[model samples]
Target chain A: MRNRLKELRAERGWSQQDLAERLEVSRQSVNAIETGKYDPSLPLAFRIAEVFAMRIEEIFLKG
Target chain B: MAAYNLAFRRYIRRFVPLTIAYGASVALATAVIPDGAPASPGIIAIAVLPGLAVVGWLWAMARLLVELDDEYLRMLEVRKFLVATGTTLALTSIWGILELFTPAMPKLPVFFVFPLWCLGLAVGAVFNRLRFGAARCA
Candidate 1:
């Protein structure tokens, strides 16, 4: 999966740690997701969507 | 998170004491039971202590898996265990076959399986580092 996590986080001026804190995950997890090394689970994708106030599809795209 | 930290701390607490117990039990068993000593009840009890300590270690690991909240970290841990299991099984199978065929091969002790599994955990950690760019979950 491809995600706009980095771009969205950048637009909101949120560091990876900030987003990780908000998501209750490690900063490494956020970095992994951003770099496409790991794909978030459905629940985590929803949580990420909720954090960004966007739908899951908007944040994550099919690769 | 506090939960992950708490789980990790609990794992450490259990692991340390279990390790000490394992060592002490092994030393005591070695000293008390001389080579080729017949298995009495007392000797059997002493011999079982180290195995029990290894069980405690397994229990501690299972508890950590259950208590860990971070899904990704939990997944990584599960993967490590899977890798360790596979490695241990494969090596044991190969060694067993070699021992069967080669008369010069030394008989592999069953107790060494636990240590081999532990080594496999280290191998798994290296695998995680190569695949996920982190050796330790924390």
Candidate 2:
């Protein structure tokens, strides 16, 4: 579950903490997603896409 | 959606330390009590009550932890509680059975049981949290 979360976050000058707040998750969760150590649930993935105004496929790459 | 939700951060900050504190207090109490001592109903009550309080605290904390909007987080917490309950029951049953078979295996003082129980609960929480949070570094 690779994602463009980091890239998008960086573009907005948002730290993982910033992204996690928006997603209503712990910062660690955000870090986990960025590092691919955790795969976000579908709704969370959708939320991320929604935040970035992109399609889910554009943010997440299935392995 | 926007980026760190205050509620989630507050949840973690509040509960993680509570779990750790409960565990440390229980462990300390367990270690302080002598294993061989006279047992009585009163002593057992003393040993069990504080541990029971810690459980209550953990339960209360769990409620707060799940107050956020993440269903996944809520699910993980519920699973942790279930695991803790099952493990505690199994451990207690085994200890009781063991006592019936051999009374000489360093009979833990009745007064110490509460602290030990609390300690067990605390340790259980720590393990659950670690398992859940470990991937954060990955």
Give each candidate's fraction of reference contacts reproduced.
0.31, 0.19
Which consecutive 10 residues in model 1 chain A have the weakest lDDT in total?
A24-33
Number of clashes recorded per candidate:
0, 6
Model 1 lDDT per residue over B54-135, tens place: 9999999999999888777787888889899999999999999999999999999998999999888888888888999965
Candidate 2: residue pairs that collide: A20-B4, A21-B3, A21-B4, A21-B5, A22-B3, B47-B114
Cα-based lDDT at residue B56, candidate 1? 97
What DockQ, between 0 and 1, does each candidate earn? Answer: 0.63, 0.21
lDDT by residue for model 2 (B56-117), tens = 66665565555545544555555555555666667767777787798775565565454454
After superposition, the stretches of candidate 2 with alpha carbons farther than 4 Å from their true spots are: B1-59, B70-83, B108-117, B121-138
lDDT of 2 by residue, A1-63 (tens): 788888999999999888887877777678778888678888988888888999999999988
- Chain A TM-score of model 2 comes to 0.94
lDDT of 2: 0.66
